[model samples]
Target chain A: MQGLAHQLIAGIATGGIYASVALALVMIYQSTHHLNFAQGEMATFSTYIALTLIQAGLPYWVAFLATLVISFGIGVFIERIMLRPMQNASVLANVGVFIGLLLVFRNAMGWIFDYTIKAFPTPFDTGTPLFGGLVSGHELGSTAVTLVVLGLVYVFFRFTKLGLGMRAAAFNASSSRLVGIRVGWMLALGWGLAAAIGAIAGIMIAPVVFLEPNMMLGILLYAFAGALLGGIDNPGGAVLGGFLVGIIENLGGAYLVGTELKLTLALGIIICVLLVRPTGLFGRVVQSRV
Target chain B: MDAGRDRIGTGIALPAAGAAERSAARPLRLLGLLGLVAVAAVLPPLFASSYQLFQLTLALIFAIAILGLNIVTGFNGQISLGHGAFYAVGAYATAIMMSHFDLPWWETLPVSALICAAFGFGIGFPALRLGGLYLALTTFSLAVAVPQILKYKGVEDWTGGVQGVFISKPDAPEGLGLDADQFLYLVVLAFAVAIFLLAHNLLHSRIGRAMRAIRDHSIAAEAMGMDIARIKTRTFALSAGITGLAGALSAIAIEFVAPDSFSVELSITLFVGLVVGGVGSIVGPLFGGVFAVFVPNLAESISRAAPGVIYGVILIFFLYLLPQGFAGFPQRIRALLRRRPEG
Candidate 1:
């Protein structure tokens, strides 16, 4: 029973991070219909920047804020420079470009920061029993922040004019353009927001685990599973899908299998789900244009 | 009267009439392809240095694997990120069969391919519709999960886990005066050429046209009377089968097959090669295979500051600057050199 609760708690915490990342992935998929293969790598690079700043004796909050702004700018720049130019290209070419970006960011990080694992300090209280020492409050704090981020995204997409414009652009770019909405800016905005979200995810995740050039590879997989499981189009679906995956993975690892086979089992489940429910758990069934 | 040569000239219009004309005009296309094969056939003797020959050998084997990727992602328009798992499956099966059952090399090759094809068929049953990110995730998970599952405790006898198992030397005939490097390259070359030609034919065949159609627009293709699901699933299996053959040969060449050798990194390399070498073209995989083999080697030699970083950077640059890939370089270069080139 104790193990079950522990696994549940851990799953939710990790799942929060996955959901947060999945939220960004969902946003990008909605706006561009192209998956940003470099999302994790971008997050990783920004997180490293934050780590470098914090290590230089800057206050944690200041560094965090600075990192957010810089990440936003970087995202916008990437959109303008890389994606925008390839926007009207063929699907394969666009995908190839992003895959290229993934390589660039990953390699840049490896070259600049070094590939060896390094510890990044967390803003939340560390080495202290914040939650009466029963469980690590760090994870709890992470979940709280993820929830807050999710809420902000919800509010942004639901109520704001910019959000409305972005949504319109996402649904149909040509129609959005006809309505005088700047579909181009909306895409840039979406990319920028996604980048910021990924940055926050990276900073939050780094302290919980060791930081390396490929640190996000595993999480990216989990988030990919989450986005696909939840229905790639819906933000809320991504969150739900993420938690579901986390819980299943943790519980499976604890009770049915050892840690080694946990991910493999999760993969099996995803494949099975795909076979049975191609539209995913939350995705709307899309009819082919037959 | 029926037994006569019967002036059988009473034929209907051939669907592939244009194909014959295209092939005749592009005689150099076949020549260029043969030129490549001749390069491989002569490599062992020309490059007596084992190191360089081994690299060529590895590249040719990987060409087979990359060719598999091209069929799915390049031709069929499905992105698979877990092919390394299939490669590993073939490798482990070969290693185990040769060491334990003492299976002959000839026997293990087909067995390895069948096992991998089975895995691919199994994965493709559900994953064909995932598309883009979902497909990427499913395959990525398979790639990551395979190694971990194999690394688990109970599989030690078959897998050797961290220690890894090595295979027996290949049974090369005595008359073939080729050294191990030369011998292995020749063996791999034979299958690689056969597979390449098979894929070439399949790509241009009726089934190939159906796959490309399905990839471009499944709905329209289905409306056009193509079975989308069947084509997609079969394409995945066919692709995996070729990759399995590569894995089997690679197992022999290196004489060692382990989980580490078949990491997601190798799969990424395969993808990078496909994209940069030009995906849909028959020659693209060959170009990609060579790039995958040579670029990293060149990078490591030029600088040791994280060779993969260099490879990744170059891959991204190529994706951005040259999406048509190296195979399209002649046209691109000609276009650049002159304002236009006559077709």
Candidate 2:
């Protein structure tokens, strides 16, 4: 019972992180209908930026705030500069653009810093356990932060004027434009919001994982699988999905196979999900208009 | 050589041999292309050093693989991220056949190509129902799994595990005045040219038209009586077969076969090359092939780690600035020049 309890708790902690990242992905995907293949990589870059600032002797909170602002700008700039040009391109070409940005973002990160692995400092001190258990404060802190972010996103989408405009533009650009909404700004704003959310997730998760150029590739896969499983179009579902995937993966490795096969197992689950339900557990079946 | 001259069928731009050039001019154009191919086929043997001979030879073999990728992704508009797996299949097929059964080079290469094509078709058949990202994920998973299958302890005795197979060079025919490296390069160059010529001619066939049509609009093509599933499977087979052929030649050139060589990194770079070179044009594969040769050579000139970083950076830069690729550079410059005179 204790071993199973430990497994479930560990899974929940990891799942919390995955859910946070996946929710950001869900936001972008919901608006654009295109997967930002560079989302995790972009997050990694933001975290690295924060780490660099903090390393240069800035306070953690200040550095975090500054990085968040920069990340917002970066996201908007990406939509305007890179994506705007390839607006009507074929699917292959559009995907190519995302891949191109991914490369640029990751390579720039490598170029800027030493390109070596660095340990990010956690907000919580290293001495204390969370709940008379072996789990650390950092994990608990991450889950709590993720919940707070999710709640904020829910409130923004549910209650705010700007958020409603963003959703309107996403639902139908033509109608949104006709309705006097600034559709273009809405798109850019969507990217900015997603990037800011992603940046927070990045900073939160960096302390748990090592910071490197290729660090996001693995996490991106997990987040993607989680997002898809949770229903990519639903932000809430995406969060729920990430937590479920994380827990299942953690417990599966602990009980059945082992750690080395975690990726293969994750992929297997994704394939199974794809086979059974292409729209995922919570997604609506979108009708193609072409 | 001008694309305009070749476009004799009005704005139709269909893949068949142009109606206007169906006479003596057509044969002459074939001769010119063949002549260029002939020179390329012979040049590797003329190089004195084995290193130059080896790199160019590997490039020739890789050209075949890239060309296959070109046809599938560039022309057919089906994105494949698992080409290196097909290459691995071909290499292991050839190596296992040669080492275990004492098969000669002549027999091994063709058989390897066939088996890979068949295997490719098999993988493609089951997965043909999928679309877009799903297809890509399936292929990526396959690429990751194949090497593991090769390295599995159950088949280690046959597949050589992680150490892989060390192949002996084939004996030369009597008094050909050819060293083994030079000989292998020449043999590979012949098949590569054959592939290029066939692919070139193929783009002029009904199948080629079907491929382009599918790329442009699959639903419309299906309405127009193009069998998407059959042709798509065939595209996978042909692409996989060419990649496999390249793999066989690569195995001979390296005289070694290991799972490590055909990593996901190799797949990424190969796809990057295709994108950076231009996807749909005939010159695209050639441009990608040149980039393939130059990037690593340039990397060797610089530091070792810089290659991946540099390659990624260059690919991204070109993708943002020139989506069409290096082949499109001249046209872009010409457009700039045309505007500058008036400006």
Candidate 3:
């Protein structure tokens, strides 16, 4: 019973991180209806930037803030420069470009940072357990960070004028334009916000996984499953889905399929969820017009 | 050449080639294409070293795989980022049969093809519910999970775990008395040509038109009495079957199969091949195969450690400059030339 308690805590902590990434995915999907295959790589690249800043003697929080800003700019620039021209291209062409971005970000990280795994610094002292030994300090710290980011994102979308414009654009671009929204800028802003969110996820995950070029590959798969589970188009559902996936993955890896088949377990969940509820648990049914 | 002349004259008079002209020119164009293939088939043996022949064989093998990808993705408009899993299954099917059952390498092709088709069909059921991006994600998950599944302890006995399985290269038949490299090249060429021709015919059939209609507008196609689900699943099966056959050939060519060999990167490479060669074109996969085999060597020559970055740059450049891919380059040139005459 004690062991199970520890695993559940650990799963929730990791699920919090997955929730952050899944929310980023949902943000882009909501705006563009395209799943950014490069989302994980972009996050990894931001985390690496943070690593370089820390190595160069900046404080951890300072590096984290700077990384977030730079990542946002990078995301917006990618939208304005690369993806804008492809806005009217075929789905295949757009997918090709996404894959291109993924290759560039991932291999560029490998080339610039080298492939050797490195230890990431935790903001909290991780030597001691927290919450009566159920969670480590790092786990508690990271989950708090993830929750804070999620809260801010919700508030931003719910209250801000720019957020409303972005939502308007995503729901209907021409309608938004008719209502005097700058749809193009709204799309760019969406990318920037999603990138910032992804950076936070990467930073939180780095300390646990140890930073490396391929660190996010498995986590990204989980995030995909989570996003699909909750609803690829619904932020709230995706967040819930992420937490559920993390717990399911932990328990499934521990008791059922074993750790060796953990990734396969993710695949199984994605297929099942997709087959059973294509709109996801919380998503709206998409209507196709003739 | 005569067809070109006829079309050029048509620009000055009629809109384009009429049926009579098309009929007259069809046999000539077919002969020309065949003649090119004949030259390609015969020349490598005459001048190249054995190692070069082996490289060519690998290229042909990749061409076959890319063509398979083209069937579902290019023609049928389904995006699969996990065809690598099918390739791996096919290779393993051959590897298990050859090593455990002591089956002849040539005899394992059908078994491998059948197994991969079955897996594709199983995957297709779930795919029937998913659309473009969702299907891509599901397939991507499959690609990411494949290596771990192959390395699972339960299958370690057959999979050889991390060390992977290796088989000896098939020898030349006794009557042929050819070297190993020569024999393998001929075998791959025969398969490549046969499959290419088969895909060509498949894409031009009534079913092919239906696939394209679905791609253009699925609702309209459905309203037009097309069975969208059936066409898609069957296309997926065919695509997997063709790629699996290629995998069997690739296993024979490389003489080894490992989980690492079929990582998500392999799927990306095949996707890159399809894009760089030109999607939705019959000849595109042939060029794609060449790109898949040679570009890495080119990248390696430029930088020892960062071939992937180089590949990424080249891919971006292709997307930016030649979005129609190399296969469409000739038509772009022709269009330009035709406009020049008018100007």
Candidate 4:
């Protein structure tokens, strides 16, 4: 029973990270209707930049804030420079470009930072026990960080005019344009926010997984499963799905399939969810018109 | 079919008809295609070195894989970023059959093809529900997870875990004067031509038209009484079968099978090949095959550490300059020349 509790706690901690990345994926999907395959790579690059700042003697919190801002800018820049031109192109071409972006970011990180795994510093200290030893200090702190980010995103979308404009643009670009909203800028903003969120996920995850060029590949897959399981369109569902996936992954790894097949477990969940519920648990069913 | 509806539906009636008329003066295009095949078959044996023959064989194998990808993705408009998983399945099937059962390499091809087709059929059921980005994600997940699955402890008996399994190269018949590499190259070439011809025939058939109709408008195709689900599932199977054949050929040519060989990078390479070669054209996969076989080596030669970066840059450059791909170059040039004369 204690072991199971420990597994759940660990799963929730990891799931928080997955939720953040899943939310980022959902954000990009919301606007472009195209999944950014490079989202994971982009987050890794953002984390590298944060590491550079920390290595330059800046405080951890300062580096974190700087990384978020820089990641947002990079996302917007990518949208303006690479994606905007291909807006009217075929879906295959668009997807091809996204793959290209993934390669670029992944290889660029290896080129700049090298493929050596580096230890990332956690803001949370390891001295204290949390939740009667069920959760580590870092896990607790990371989950708290993830929730705070999620809450802030919720507030922004619910209360801010820019967020509302972005939502309107994503919901109906033509109608949003008719209403004088800058639809293109809204998309860029969406990409930026998504990048920022992905950066946080990466930053939080790196300490646990250790930082490397390919650190986020497995996490990204889990997040993909989560996003799909929760309904890729529903942000709240995605978050819930992320935690659920995390719990399942942990419990399955512990009791079911073992650790070697954990990635396959994620894949299996994705296939099962897709087969059973295409609209996802939270997504509205869309009808194809003749 | 109504000519007007064909025009509206296909958007290629006039150009295709004109091309057919042009073909009438040059005998049949089929004859020309066969002649090209004959040249491909005969020339390498006469002039190419062993190393060159090996490269050509690898390129042909890639062509088969890309053609398979083109079936479901290019023709049916289903994006599969996980064809490499099918390819891996095919390779492993061949490897295990040959290594474990001591089965003849020739016999494993059909078995591999059947296994991969089954996989595709199973995947297609889920794919019926997931569309567009969701499907791509699921497939991408498959690609990422496949290597790990292959390395799992339960499968280690057959898979050999990380070390992988290697097979002996098949030798030429005693009557033939050719060596193993040359024989393998010829074998791959024969398979390539046969598969290419098969794809060509399939794409030009009535079923091909239905597949394209579904791709262009699934709802409309369904309204017209086409069973969209059956067609798509079958297309997936066919595509996987062909790709599996390519993987079988690759295993023979390389004489090895490993989890590392069938990475997500392989899937990406095939996809890049499809896009760069042109999506829908019959010969596009041939171009894609050449790109897949040669580009990474070229990138590595330029910079070993950052070959992926180079590949990415070149990919973006091509996407920017030639959105329609290398297969569209001839058409683009013709359009340019026509415009120049008019101007």
Candidate 1, superposed: residue stretches over 4 Å from native: A127-133, A288-290, B1-39, B130-133, B302-306, B333-343
Q: Rank the candidates by DockQ, best first.
A: 4, 3, 1, 2
Cα lDDT of model 2 by residue, A178-232, tens digit: 9899988889888887888888878887887778876766667677778878887
Model 3, range A146-262, lDDT digits (tens) per residue?
Answer: 999999999988999988898899999999999999999999989999899999999999999999988888888999989989998999999999999999998887879999998
Global fold similarity of model 3 (TM-score):
0.96
For candidate 2, the share of real interface contacts preserved is 0.15
The most accurate candidate by lDDT is 4
lDDT of 2 by residue, B1-343 (tens): 3354235223446455555655548788878888887787676577548888878777777678888888888777887777888889888888888899988877999899998899888767645555556555556556555655666666789889899999977755769988887787778778877888799778768888788778777899889998897888799889899889888878877888987887655666677778887777666777787688778788757654466667766766766677778767776888799999898
lDDT by residue for model 3 over B1-343, one digit each (tens)?
A: 3233334324444334565687788899899989988987789977889989999998999999999898889878999988899999999989888988899998999889989988998887786656668778988899999999999999998999888898888899899868888888988999998999888777778887788777767888889998898889888898999999999888888889999999998999899999899787788888999999998988887654466776677677787788767887888899899999789
Alpha-carbon shift of residue B218 in model 1 (angstroms): 2.8
Candidate 4, position A170, lDDT: 90
What value does the lDDT take at residue A227 in candidate 1? 80
Which regions of candidate 4 deviate over 4 angstroms?
A288-290, B1-31
Local lDDT at A208 for model 3: 91
When candidate 2 is compared with the true two-chain complex, its DockQ is 0.27
lDDT of 1 by residue, A1-290 (tens): 66677789888888888888888888999888787777888999989999999989889989998998999999999899888878777776776666667767887787788889998887676577654544576888888888888899889989999899999999899999999999998999988999999998899899878889888877777787788788878888988988887887778878888777766766876776687776668888766544
Which pairs in model 1 have colliding backbones?
A100-B316
TM-score for each model: 0.91, 0.88, 0.96, 0.96
- Across A164-191, the per-residue lDDT of candidate 4 in tens digits comes to 9999999999999999999999999999
